[model samples]
Target: MAMGIHKFSKRRGRGARAPMAEINVTPLVDVMLVLLVIFMVTAPLMKAGIPITLPDSRAKPLDQTPKQVTITMNAEGRVFLDDDELSPGELAERVGSLPRGADGAMPLVTLRADKALEYGRVVGVMGELNRAGITAISLVTVAGGAPAETAKKP
Candidate 1:
């Protein structure tokens, strides 16, 4: 009877496996996968969009997005054209090489400059865009809840 009875003695692997001495990562992996799917589903829904009433229209929807160019100026004064880096001196010539719209209109230029940048730097970039024959430039800014008092120069 003693021989028939088995025990997980102190000796390694003599009985039941040592309480897994390691973490059961299967549960952690499952949890992480669930969170990833949840975020993937909800991400687009979280986009900020303005609510507006649209007029009824029988016109067919436009086929393609409007042509526009994005120019970003980082805090370090680096310039990017739709993700391509450009030197300050190359702005005018490179911008001129960009294609115009199918209707022959200049593609709208969106200027994004870091707030900490000097005032003159931003203006200089705008001047380059103007010299490139881009006149429909739009300045992107953070939306304020209400109109604020004007800022004055010291």
Candidate 2:
């Protein structure tokens, strides 16, 4: 009886050690996949900027797409045109020189500004555009709510 029991115990021990030696990789793979998805989703939002709180305004959406010249305003009041890194004076001159289309309509101007920037700087840029004879201007904004229309006083 002792000899028979010893043989049976050895057989069970062999299979038990084999399973322990074989690495269980499923848990490790699951963790790596989860981290990859988290990085992919969050990476873009990280690159945009530090967030800012914007003042509420009621403004109308633009009707049509036109040739756009982008102007950016930083909090310090420095301005940029299409990433050309121009001063306000240069912005006026360059915008004034941009030729009209064959239809004689002025090129559309778009302004992107940090929300922390002063309101006066934005108005100054629009004022410059008006002085440059570019009457059609559009402010680019991310849609957070339903668009609002401002009644213009003629």
What would the per-residue lDDT of candidate 2 be over residues 1-154, giving only the tens digit for each residue? 6656555556754463334457789999999999999999998687334233333445555554567677777666677777667854787788899888889877788777777787887888898888989887778665555456669999
What Cα-based lDDT does every candidate model obtain? 0.72, 0.72
lDDT of 1 by residue, 50-114 (tens): 22222233334332246877787877788888778897599999999988777888777877777
Which residue segments of model 2 deviate by more than 4 Å? 1-66, 145-154
C-alpha positional error of residue 92 in candidate 2 after TM-score superposition, expressed in Å: 1.2
Per-prediction count of colliding residue pairs?
A: 1, 0
Q: Between which residue pairs do clashes occur in model 2?
A: none
RMSD of each: 11.9, 8.0
